[model samples]
Target: MPGYLEVLIILFVALLLFGNRLPNVARSLAQGIVEFRKGLKGEPENQEEKKALPPAGGQQAHGIPQGTQGGANAQGSQPPPPAQQQDPS
Candidate 1:
């Protein structure tokens, strides 16, 4: 635990360094963190999870519409079907 004097010192340093910009910087940092986490949450359905979806790009597979693998554009409503992607290895 930080001592009272240590806490005061930290606050004084923050006040000296940030002055009036601290709140704005904190808000921006929080928003950035939220966006970053949203990105990091990864593909919603994942490439491995199977779900019923409409035919993708007028193409059909096994009597069902073939769909784009995970990541954005997974939904049939998205613009032009995303190109098929494969692992580099």
Candidate 2:
């Protein structure tokens, strides 16, 4: 650990370099410390887990239409048929 005189010298140098920007620098340093502690605690860095999972009800994951999959029709409705294309001469 730095002695008192060494700490004072470091603070003097920082003041000379940062001048009026010292408060902003200090704020950023404090925030970095907070995030570091959160990381050490294994906290999730984002809110993704707070988001709702896919409903327990549907064919959503398999690229199948919502109302048709595994012989189940969500709305008891049939999907529209693919259009027949006629070639133009």
Candidate 3:
């Protein structure tokens, strides 16, 4: 880890290179950290990017075509045949 003097020297060099833009750079860095934390928590910071991603499942984001079901349970299964009924006296 760097000592206080090394930290000051690095800050001074950054000030020399970034001058008035230092605040903006710091703000950008803080925003990046916040966004990173949100991502780590399984949340997206950018709604536009979220909106642009494909929807869940195999269906397209646009719309499902005419008569096709778009999920796992809809794939391949048949109902059991009905049981025979007995007449009551």
Candidate 4:
């Protein structure tokens, strides 16, 4: 972590460089980082992970494989449709 003095110096440089848009710039950078992390996890950018390990209602959610756990849509908020078999012809 950057120390207080280092942080203050960085802030001073930012104030000199960005004048007034520094906060907004920082906010956008943080949001971008969060989105990137979610992408890396194959998760939706802003959705919360379900507590599937606990099985919220003791029954499986619709469209999800029985006894399946982890990943999003675990709570059935946006369960994927059933898979269709492909033709071999």
**lDDT pick, better of 1 and 4:** 4
Per-residue lDDT of 1-89 in model 1, one digit per residue for the tens? 99999999999998998889989999999999977886798645444443555546855556543454454656655678679999999
Q: What is the TM-score of each candidate against the true structure?
A: 0.36, 0.39, 0.35, 0.36
- List lDDT for all candidates, in order: 0.74, 0.79, 0.81, 0.78
Q: Model 3: what TM-score?
A: 0.35
Model 1 has an lDDT value of 0.74
Model 1 misplaced stretches (Cα beyond 4 Å)? 1-3, 43-55, 59-89
Clash totals for all candidate models: 1, 0, 0, 0
lDDT of 4 by residue, 1-89 (tens): 88999999998998898988878989999999988888898975433435334456677667878657666755765869989999999
Clashing pairs in 1: 55-65
- Residue 25 of model 3 has an lDDT of 84
Residue 58 Cα positional deviation in candidate 1, in Å, after optimal superposition: 3.0
Model 3 misplacement above 4 A: 1-17, 48-89
Worst 10 residues of 2 by lDDT: 67-76
TM-score, predicted candidate 4 vs. hidden true structure: 0.36
For TM-score, the strongest prediction is: 2
The window of 10 residues in a row where model 4 has the poorest summed lDDT is 45-54
